[model samples]
Target: MSQERRNFDKEFKLMTVELSKSRESIQELAKELGIRAELIYRWRPEYLEKPEGSFTGHGKPRHTPEEAEIARLKKQLRDVEMERDILKKGHQHLLQGRREIYRFIACQSSRFPVDKMCEVLKVSRSGYYSSLKGTVSKRAKENQELLSLIKQEHKKSRQRYGSPRISQALRANQVQVSRPRVARLMKQAQIKARMVKRFRVSTDSK
Candidate 1:
């Protein structure tokens, strides 16, 4: 009885070629992968020369020029659509702070690729990954505590107090905080003081 010949897919061939570049011994890699060393040696040059067109199995038809052009256009369309979706969902965050942008990316990470989101949002990939670790600095913790207090005081005043009044009110309670910092936090939290209309005892002349 004759033994059937083994067949390798394009992915496997490409992976083998990539492994061959980093590996010290092609023979060792081939032995581990259960293939002949000559296969890696043959795949390397072909992959290096035309990576996209390489290792299209023996019977498979090669892509025509029109097909290749269509493939390229389809890729471009997909990329454009991805960017449009990202922007449509995350446009508001773009106008806000970097932390807000990071939060948006983290929230939308399930829908889109993190690296692509980072690229589209103009934020560093390392920063986005670091945000994933959920590390809050001492100052940030302090600010959060201060913001809580500010919210309480603002509500107590019935939204009639701005940052300066809030700062004075905080100090009266023995909480040492700056007005500018209060203003910034208020801006971030969208806390605004309501304007009071004063009554004037004046009659209109007819």
Candidate 2:
């Protein structure tokens, strides 16, 4: 195997071991690996899925008739595992070839007309153009800043600001926005206004 494959295997194994607890996120992992998170996402050249079986109990002897049957079962299991390993290696080879093809197409596209890449890669022209769009537009970023300000106003009022109240607050701050649009964005963001729950109200007393 190449050094790249070796690195991929090590990284994959490390990720798999902590998959259940991978709250650290791939963005964090990319920072550690000194690459973009998108690169990290595209790193699984061979197998993107979790691999199976372990190399434990290789020399341990079977203890009873049941254990002996277990040993036999283990032997069959190893044979099946060997077959799977062969398949994985084949898939890895195919993935490497595909990566090479994509890179060649990208480089060629940079030089020549992109119609060639569209024909070769079999992707739509509109779809390709759409992919070039930046993550967050300036207007969207400005709207987000306004949202932060709106949240601050809502916070000051102890989150009692529903769409109407938030609209009023925004207008008061010279925002000049509509309540319905604010409602839509807030709903899309899942930022519901605070209300006195029975649990909280019942528990509170003088």
Candidate 3:
């Protein structure tokens, strides 16, 4: 048979499944449609001889327990990794947003104009105000106060102690808080105090 005929036969098998499954015989349908019975008979055997596990796109796939578990674990792992990346990005965005906010405020009150700052920062006033609502409560104020104490200690220990070291210093002073929180406050204050500019010392003995 030609490839085209074979493909047509497969489609004919699919289209004729319901009619084939009915009680009426292929010979009866051939007589009713005035066509050859051989065409129907040829495909009928192919349909009957189909493997038990084969599907015709009518229902959900049946999976083994291990396969299902493996799929579920893979999806869960993907979701968790996505969440971690989102958290990291959010932290970085928050820090950058804080810097922009500081510049905005500084411009409005100091040398830079608010409108000019807005243009330079490439952020709208609404977004700037929204970030201002980072925390709002007495507890939040207390957290800021605790953060200031940590900063004081951090400065005393070493001006360049990043959030992690500041968190350690907080622990040593009996102030309990997470490193993430320390990092947040440091970001908010924009206090990256230790800033040593790198330069190659030219010790050429000429």
Best by TM-score: 1
Top lDDT hit: 1
Candidate 3, residues 171-192, lDDT tens digits: the string is 8878888989888778877777
Where model 3 places Cα greater than 4 Å from the true spot, the runs are 1-136, 193-206
lDDT of all predictions: 0.89, 0.59, 0.62
Mind giving the per-residue lDDT tens digits that candidate 1 earns over 1-206? Answer: 99777898988887888788888999999999999898788888877767778778651436779989999999999999999999999999999978899999989989999988988999999877877799776788999999999999999999999999999999999999999999999998999999989998998999
TM-score for all models, in order of appearance: 0.48, 0.33, 0.30
Better of 1 and 2 by TM-score: 1
User: How well does model 3 score by local distance difference test?
Assistant: 0.62
Residue 118's lDDT in candidate 2: 52
| Model 2: lDDT of residue 153 | 77
Model 1 TM-score relative to the real fold: 0.48
